[model samples]
Target: MRTDSPRLSRPATFVRAFAIACALFFLFPRHAHSQIHPTVSFEVASIRPVAGGESGGEGGTRSQIETTADGLTMRNIDLSEMIEWAYKLQHYQLSGPNSLAGSRYDLRAKSGDHVAESTLRLMLQDLLATRFKLQLHREQKKTSVYELVIAKGGPRLPKDKSATIPPSYPKETFPRVVDGGFVFQNVSLGDFAQQLTEIRTIDLPVIDRTGIPGVYDITLKSAASALLDPSGPSILTLIQEQLGLKLVSAQDLIEVVVVDRFEPPSAN
Candidate 1:
């Protein structure tokens, strides 16, 4: 008589579910699985408050965080801005304590190795969790926002005539501060939307509604005064006039990052 082999005990419900997901991921087409999220953490990190609480030249996304082979430095950046970089969300998309909104910090994080900008964001998230006790959730909320769309005439910016389809983005990326504002070359529509969102021109994060796809060259500039004047040409106007893209007003379900709690960092 053959003895029956002992049956393997089933794992907990959550574990079973996870195992099933993994099985499906491997058994099915690769595209069926979600893209792997890059995670990079700092080997040694320090977070300090900006003494003056004032954002100077080093402020804004353009100069927010710089990652080198050895480490990364974030200067004069508020928690709000930091979250924006970590999650790639707009400041308007985040909500938390009033103080946290304006509280800026100088962060020095090192990993001893160079990583992609996308990976750097992951490291920033880890740093926030370890230091700031940051926590957040995502929800879709109905909000009135501008959708970037091609105007009746089409885009004012010219397509890169010499741009030939390449396997990837250009190796020689142009400097962002070409003419004082922001310039992009060999950029895709998705990348352009992301750049526009970081500019803080529109009150709400812009949603790209343009049906256009592919890479192109873009130059955008707006006088601070122009954006401040309600009657003057705003970023929306600039996009329409210069880029031939319009930000149409519409209500859509937008992803909003909800901050549950954020405690101040511990001692350095």
Candidate 2:
């Protein structure tokens, strides 16, 4: 008599489990990626002030020219293509923690399209930092301005309260350190004054005074007299020199990117 037991059917269960595991592995394969390393930031050592030569013109009628001949002149520098490539090269390493020092990567677009190698992000940051000599600082402050109020029979309030300029900006009140490039925030006024003697000035055309508002307008502190000219050496030049990178053209599309190959250092 042949014995029919439950053990005879155990092989089928093992086969089913193995097949399921294989199916899952192919369905969601891990993307092995690496982390882009950040390089050392650089700073400008000295700046020399440049003076503009006067254009020869005396009296209003001193300049006279014949307009019988008509002409048009155009000047152009073709840096647009270079800028586009630089922008494309700034891919941020979007990856998670990995075990290895160098992570494996298969960079791709949202549609699963292949992009450049995963190491691009670290290369770009290092390029910008070294070339631009970018310097960053942070500071914060609590603004206090007296509002003129008609107290009993005192005075009338100004039409524009926001426009009213405040008196002295106390250091204690302005304790928050926001990101900026002020070299004297932590130093004493005396030390800052001495530091200024070492710097050079190069007067450049002003595009925007958003970053250095104090340079454009007077602040509460008399010691905040440091001036800057935008036309000369700046963060923009530093990035170009250290990293061989430039801004993307006005027409180029910018996107936040992530890659599979790179991982952060903390993972190590």
Candidate 3:
């Protein structure tokens, strides 16, 4: 005699299907479907408050920022200045608490290996977020800015023959200050405009509108004091006469970083 097998119930069939699905899931590699990407950060970092809180003279409290392929070092720098450097922004591009500049700190950060300046900036950003508990956002606003353009006589800039097509980053030598003025070697117009923004005399955002390409060697003979001396020629006049460049005052919509929150760095 033949016998019939027992039929499975609905609940038993559902449990059997669920068991098979779990078994298939575990059979696959755990990370096959998903990948985790971690934020870029420095391998080692140290931040310490400076004593006396004195200015570095001429350049304000920020003494200097030194960066290499492997790391970065900022001496006698304030949070505001660090923010400016880390974000590649001008002073006008940042809106934050005046207290950000009140305190000074020396920061040294190292990476596991050699990296680009762009990567170093990201590491600095990460450090700020983690150490200072910093929070910020960007917004557009109409502001005063100076546009660097070719003057009536045209640009007197001499193209640097030795300069490469794409200039290297973190140039070894920046514009140097002489007794009377400044000198730029193998610098682009955009870079020149950026340097102008740091002048206490200019004291305004500078935009490169010359539309000129290639690097140049430039020298401005007018003293920084000329910008303030009523009897002396203004920077506008000097620039036109010496560099064949003009700074036109204009209003523009610019993106500015607004600091929402920042706290003293946590213990090292």
TM-score of each: 0.63, 0.18, 0.73
Predicted structure with the largest lDDT when compared to the true one: 3
Candidate 1 clashing pairs? 156-243
TM-score, prediction 2 = 0.18
Q: Candidate 3 regions off by >4 Å?
A: 1-38, 53-62, 158-177, 183-188, 200-203, 213-218
In candidate 3, list every pair of residues with a backbone clash: none
Tens digits of lDDT, candidate 2, 1-268: 9987756357888898899999988886654222233242212111111123221222121111111111110111011111112233211111122332122111111212222322232233343234333222223323221111112333121122223433212111011212433323322222222223223431211111112112111111222232344654563343234323222212222232222232221210
Report every candidate's CA lDDT.
0.69, 0.25, 0.79
Give the worst 10-residue stretch by lDDT in candidate 2: 66-75
Per-candidate clashes, comma-separated:
1, 32, 0
Worst 10 contiguous positions by lDDT, candidate 3:
165-174
- Model 3 lDDT tens row, 1-268: 9999998999999999999999988898577655454478999998988877553322344356777667887777889878988898866788998999888887888997988888888899999999999999999999889999999968787665545644233331235766667776556787788778877778789999999887777778755657558699887788899888899999889999999999999888
